[model samples]
Target: MAALRPCTLLLPVAALLFFCAAGFAVRFPDPPGAWLLSLAAVAAIAAPPLAALLRLFGPARWLAALALLSAFAFAVESLGVATGWPYGRFYYGEGLGPLLGGLVPYLLPVSYVPLVVGAVAAARHPRSRPLWTLRSAALLTLIDGVLDPGAALLGFWVWPGGGPYYGVPASNYLGWLLSGAVSSAVLVLLWPRGSPAPPALLDGTLLALAFWTGVAAFGGLALPAALGVALLAAFLARRAGIRGCARVTFLKKN
Candidate 1:
């Protein structure tokens, strides 16, 4: 077994702390408390993936990815809020902290970029960029499948039209699909030549799945909870398969 890095432990610890705090915060309504908790949650979720990206791709590439994705997310979100073309009409509440231009949250990219990085890193068959992009986009959508409902329940965002799934419109997911595809393409382009995604990259994604699964279950949203569990299972299975293959290769080499 490969030795675990000390930094790798930070993700699980942060996740657990956030999950516990979130559980309490959800039950008891405290505006100031919720705002602080939400900030903490964003940091906890985003830090690991950003670290992984830096470790894998170096600072220059990491910065590039971060800048580009942040701009893209803000633009798309602003457009969505104003025009409602892609993600449906959604308005943000004050819980997420200050809104940029009174439109989207300032911390949008901090949370958004990590999801794209983690999803692309978790994708199978990295050599095939097209397939990787498609799969990563789908994975992003699935992650949103868990996230939107829980966000709605928590009053992070409100979908005025309100669709079948926990007040989130279907158009929001379609927006995610499009956004995910574009984000995946950007990651693929920025990826270092002849380098595979680091295994540690998925840590952030796993933590997200675990946290959201708990949130969904706590909120009594069965479908989103199930989807979170299923996504976690699929990712874990993929990790296990990769490890098994590595072991076989090592034994053969020996």
Candidate 2:
């Protein structure tokens, strides 16, 4: 890990604490101030990932990626709100803060950019663009599988009649696939030339994953929580394996 300032480290730590508090709050029946807790949880969780990504990619490339992702997310969300195409028909309920032009939330990028960056980092296969994009898209969708159900149960948004897999429609996942793939492509196209810090310790993906799983478990969503936990374990194992290989290579070179 780089020499990140104590203040920088605090962002993710604060996010983790708020998420834990929100989980406990949501676990109760008709919990007081649940909306505020949930809102704080989301905002806090997104912070460290954004900061970490910016540092990894540097400001120039990071800014470009950020602009592209933010604009795309806003446009798509506005369209979704207006026409209900991707992500199914849904409306915000409470505690998402102010809307941009009364359409999408001003901080919509904060909710999305981290997941996109993290997935890209994890799935960046050097040889095959298609495979890299596919892995990125798949990882991003898997994260939503963990996130959406918990949010739905907490009434972050309403899905009307609901659908299979804990009231989130199958179509929503389909939408995520499409969106995730497209976003991955854009990110890949804009990938920075220099080598970034290794993905494992680069950012808040693991932290985000833990928070998502914990919230799901606290909200009584077993399957999604288990899946998230499983993914986190796999990622950690992969990272450890890479480190072991790197050490072997270093010893041979020396």
Q: List RMSD in Å for every model shown.
A: 5.0, 6.1
Worst 10 residues of 1 by lDDT: 245-254
The TM-score that candidate 2 achieves is: 0.80
For every model shown, what is its TM-score relative to the native structure? 0.88, 0.80
> What are the lDDT scores of the predictions, listed in order?
0.78, 0.70
Q: For candidate 2, lDDT tens digit of each residue in 102-191?
A: 767776787788778778877778777788899999988998998888777766667886889899899889888999998999888777
Worst 10 residues of 2 by lDDT: 244-253
TM-score of 1: 0.88
Candidate 2 local distance difference test against the native: 0.70
User: Candidate 1 — what's its lDDT?
Assistant: 0.78
Top candidate when judged by TM-score against the true structure: 1
lDDT of 1 by residue, 75-162 (tens): 9999998899799999888778789999999978877887898799788565688998899999999999998898888787889889
- Stretches of candidate 2 above 4 Å error? 1-19, 28-43, 194-197, 200-202, 241-254
